[model samples]
Target: MKPLNWFRLVFSFIAVTAVCGFYLPGLAPVNFCEEDKITSDCQLHIRSRSLLQNEIQLFVNRLDSVESVLPYEYDVFDFCKDEKEKRSSENLGQVLFGERIETSPYKFKFRKDESCKKVCTKTYDTSNKKENVRLDFLKRGVELNYQHHWIVDNMPVTWCYAVEDGQNYCNPGFPIGCFVTFDGRSKDACVISSGFNKKNTYYLFNHVDITITYHSEESESWRGARLVSARLEPKSIKHNSQENSQSCDGPPMDIPKETTGILNVTYSYSVKFEEDAQEESGWKQVHGDVFRAPQSGMLLSVFLGQGTQIFIMTFITLSNRGALMTCAVVLWVLLGTPAGYVSARMYKSFGGEKWKTNVLLTALLCPGIVFADFFLMNLILWVEGSSAAVPFPTLVALLALWFGISVPLTFVGAYAGFKKTAIEVPVRTNQIPRQIPLQSFFTRPVPGIIMGGILPFGCIFIQLFFILNSIWSHQMYYMFGFLFLVFIILLITCSEATILLCYFHLCAEDYHWWWRSFLTSGFTAVYLFIYAIHYFFSKLQIQGAASTILYFGYTMIMVLIFFLFTGTIGFFACFWFVNKIYSVVKVD
Candidate 1:
């Protein structure tokens, strides 16, 4: 081999070795139980703990929010528990989702009934200047409608309140308090109470009483009492005078909008345990409201519609490969209208005059490229006489799905989208564009786009390994929940990374963010393709050129879909972020 060829060979060898070394099973992160149970210091306590009966009581407090100016506790926010303690262990998914599982200070024996159990209390002296400042901070947090997210036993500790239609709703997170505007308009959460109707008043929840229920194991088959449920009610009480003391049961606590002097705020909570045969599932009452479609642009709605169909197709194909193609065809045909409508609507909003071109592109652009790639791969398979080659009739059916049903539905959607008025942009575009200055290599669009994908790629690469193993190595993929969780994480990571890069570019005076945002996140597929190549060479032992082509051809299809999915996520997120920031600013 030539000198350059030798260098390439050596580099490839090292790359493959490094990938294999890092991904080896023994080098993987230790499971939570494996690390704890196998260690001598933390011996297995499951057997010993089985003999004892215990009831789980969660002490919730110290609620804070990013948008808020104050951090309040159970007593301050009228949430459950009096004091806060250390949190418990969280799984990888929980940590990624920002779940806080705090440690409980109250662990009771099974069937134990306790009354007004005092955990802790905080009494502030308004005369103290430092205390006054702290109270002011707390007041501001409530005004912002910042929320508190409390967790118990790896699940959210919910706050149940009455809603419309004589129904009750449980919210996973509750606000510290709510602000009433100077014009006597109560905030969203404050509207639940008529006592909060006072003009320009701040209502702070100062106390919460929690009732916990457990089911004691009485039979020989089981030991100890397992917590069945926990419930809490918030009370906001106003203490008019020092002699009156703190009473949780009363009208809403009113804080002066402009307090410059002495302020007394008392915080306390009461907890009790009872053995009950009945069980209550927390946060279920709000299921209808929780799953409501979030506010987003038309494009996102269309994407979601299409994504739902695709998810269904994927789920079906997992168990029924015989009808995979047929199912996909039908789903595409049914889903095409929304896709086209979304594309046309977005295009029209961008002031595109070429309706026919936009509609055709929406229907054919991605699918055409994919089909062309597939055909080329099929030709190779045919030439090699491989069984993997899709039959000509199957190809015809696919085309029929594309041209007959999918195409017509797309046109219908496009017409519908065009009939509707284009979405209004928050900020007016300047007739004259701002000139971008000279940029460093790092700040340039291409490099930024490439770097934008790395974090998202990193987030999903570990999960991707298992997926690829299932696909090529024939291993079973049963962890759908974990896969779905990872999928969500991947989406979040891609959107965030792209948004960061887009912001940097905007700051650098780059106005051409339309396609850049998409490409920035879409580039993750390129890394995925590279990893696939690395895996094929290092991990797989397939010998034939035809099988290799088939592998790559199928892989390319996956890569393309992933590209669109991630690219769409990034584009919409950046679009929303840019519009929001620009709309808020006073720009000429």
Candidate 2:
């Protein structure tokens, strides 16, 4: 080896060592219970008590609203839990994620068949101007269909209700009542019951029956009881002053149209002890309903195909010694099977005639885009004499990977895909397409597609800041768990948001959903690119045209990958949703 090559090798060793030293701890296994006993870090443990005592915390938060875009804690409503309880100390990641772990007034300890033990009552005097102001603010949140995200023992308190299939759906959160507009706009929660159909009235849930179950271990080493789970049922009741806190089972609470009278809302809960073996069987009644796969088979295949390649690259980079580009090529070439299978099946299902074009596009289109961007960035690096530039030999190797290995593997996969029959849709397509009306500007496809990305972007923009810092500012990012979680959230958000917008468009009689679904979620990458530009100008101080070009070039590669990933999610989700919905409905 040349002298400069030897020096470069040594420098690379030193750099890798420094990176490992900083991040190895984060990757290493950790014991949340260090002293043979579970610590607070474990977030759950039971300490022995002389007298039987088990207190479970119930917390509520307002759900997603356009007003603030952030949920407010139920304690903000001032309906009452002990104020002296110390709030849980959050980890750095939790704090950054904006998680709130605090005690609420709705707490319950082990007791006999307790129905509605009033925790506290909030009396808002309509006559008092200050009291009325508080009441109005609370009403406004309810009017927006704000929900309650209740948590107990660090687990979401689920709301179990039956759906159309006679199967019960357990939602992580429930609405905090809803308003019935005078114009007959029945809000989401209002539609669940006819009692809520009363015009021009706001129904607030003023009572709760909480059930906290605990299990006691006989082992002398452990004295306290472990909480199994906590459940609550929110009820809206209209009780007169004579019936104050007397019955929780009474009729739903109706806050009259007139907000001038004194409004008293009572909150309460109960707790009990149970054997560990005595698990609640209600949640298990719908075992048949529990096993369901996510929709959009083809889209998932594309995503998994790309994800497998990325995962393989990360794994090899950490566990073995080889150039990153080489590993990516090898993994990607191997992943061609899935890619071809998915694409071929999807294309066939779409009634596409050109198999060769589908296969070629799948194998080359995205890679070509990435390579073009990378080559441009490399040229800038070469011009500036930057060490980051890829050498000519490496470029040749990359081409070998793409043409020699990746292309062949992709062809093999595509060949298999072409041999297989097209995937069958549950619903048959109609011979005549429905005519779509002229959509307004706001409801147009372009506007909806643009707006669809904002939410998924919002979910990830905070995490993106750190990722950008890692890449551009030369900061170490070791939060793989957080990153993985963000990835899942992004996937879910992208799918759901796309599905929602797709549904609205379909309801508007627009059948052009295939591309719309993909673009809607994919547009989030555009927002990401925009943010990168903002970050480059405002947050970064990169000097010189070469560096600027390189920054944007690499950013484009990332944006492209993200675009495909998010777009795949939306497409598949919407695809599955449309199939499912269309299959269930009778079509002429």
Candidate 3:
């Protein structure tokens, strides 16, 4: 490569990095702080018809006004022997366990309720200064979404301290709680003997618990952090009350067993003030980073949409091996010059009538197949309320962009090819293409495609499980960097496996390497589909016809993309081997 070209690439990358690193902070979405007993920041955006169709049952959780309190619904198993027994009926009734899925937090709107509007205006005005100017604030009703989290093992217990005659302070914890509210508000409602304190304001003295609950497909419910432990730090905040000993230094707070049922590896939470985003909510853009890892199979589809474009283009542009990448490079040297130029030469080799089919199919078929799968799978996720579906419009645009560029390139090469003479192979074809090489399942295109998937899968299946868990399970998938690397590995494996198979087939005199290579590598997608089916059936018990259809719908998309990526590797690899072998032969 020319130094200037290299310099440009490096400079371009640097420029992009600078912009993302520097300017992004300001451009990035703004986040607000929340101070509830259990709080977390996350997003579950829905976008597209397929996704919305599946998730129609889930209404938008919003807090429209201040006078509203979000009603959270949860199922109490009624099995907890006592408060401490709020866990699964395991060997030990004292064990605690559960789940938590923190949906995206809501950004409170400034729009006030009608009733609160008048009071809000009057309360802030500093007009008539008499009667000690006492500011009497009205309690405006607000709304909250019900967040559901499940706890199977470690049940939650509450620890309380008697502060006033009618008020008390409570925290979620057990055993020797050490950590305090490293982050929480100073004055928030606290639950005492009666549960959550709605009418009383128990000044937060020590710590706070922000239990982030999100949906989990593994246990087939929502789950999050069980009370690991916590401490109360009264000295951190500025207290105006005449109380020197605001907090007592004790061993630790141990919540009693009676409060355990609330931890039933089962809980629910909705949303409040959701009108702004709700006018449109379904499959929103996916967040969290995308990367490759040893266990990155599950994220294959998620990362492909974002990184595939630049990634493949870079690979192709950088390799710039062009004819060198094919077996033709060797043929070019043996027969010299144009004899081994693959694009033009193979264009002729495929026969004019079939050339278009070959190139077009090679370029478009794989992506088309993958998208079909992707579209279908997205429908399934949409139904199951999973976020696996890539928006159809975006997907179509992506396809158009890829094929539009690639189609012309292939045709141009073909035109150049058909106008040229046939490549003089070191060995000439007989009256007809050779046949009769019976092979094992591991060698033929079909079985080879099937087997090629195993190693790549072995490298990533474990990771894929987690990825699928994060997606269907609704867990956090912020491990894109690691996944990206695994993507690289899968690429290598696909290419090498295809190449090895192609070389073997050619040595066996099987010249029909076109579709064979594509199919062989593309077969990996089949395995992926199989695994997905296994996951859905064995791992997830998602009810509803929508969920079933959506699962397979998104699974198909994953399969389709996988097909393209793997097929491309195989086709290119075999193409290289063919050129190299023919070029080396002494075609006299």
The sequence of per-residue lDDT tens digits that candidate 1 reaches over residues 132-217 is 66676677778776666655443566788987898999876677778899999988678877788878778886666666655544
Enumerate residue pairs that collide in model 2: 47-224, 48-223, 48-224, 81-105, 236-252, 236-253, 237-252, 237-253, 238-253
TM-score of each: 0.47, 0.48, 0.36
Off by over 4 Å in 2: 1-329, 586-588
467 in model 2: Cα distance from truth in Å? 1.3
lDDT of each: 0.65, 0.67, 0.40
Better of 1 and 3 by lDDT: 1
lDDT of 3 by residue, 1-588 (tens): 964477569769987995675433213322211223223222222121111111111111111222244322122211112222122233333222222111222112211111101000011223434311321111111111112222211223244456778676664422111111224221222322222222222221122222222222222222221112222221112221223333323222222211222210111122222122122111011000000011222222222222233235434433443442243212211221121124334445433345555445444444456556656666666666666556678767665655555445545544565677864443444443234357665556666556666776776787789889987998876655456556667777877887787666555544555566667777777777888989998999799777677677767766765665576566666656655544433222
Residue-pair clashes, model 3? 113
RMSD of 1: 21.8
Model 2: residue 393 alpha-carbon error in angstroms: 1.6
Q: How does candidate 1 score on lDDT?
A: 0.65
Please give the lDDT score for candidate 3: 0.40
Worst 10 residues of 3 by lDDT: 283-292
Question: Model 1, poorest ten-residue lDDT window?
Answer: 282-291
Q: What local lDDT score does residue 215 receive in model 1, on the 0 to 100 scale? A: 52
Ranking by lDDT: 2, 1, 3
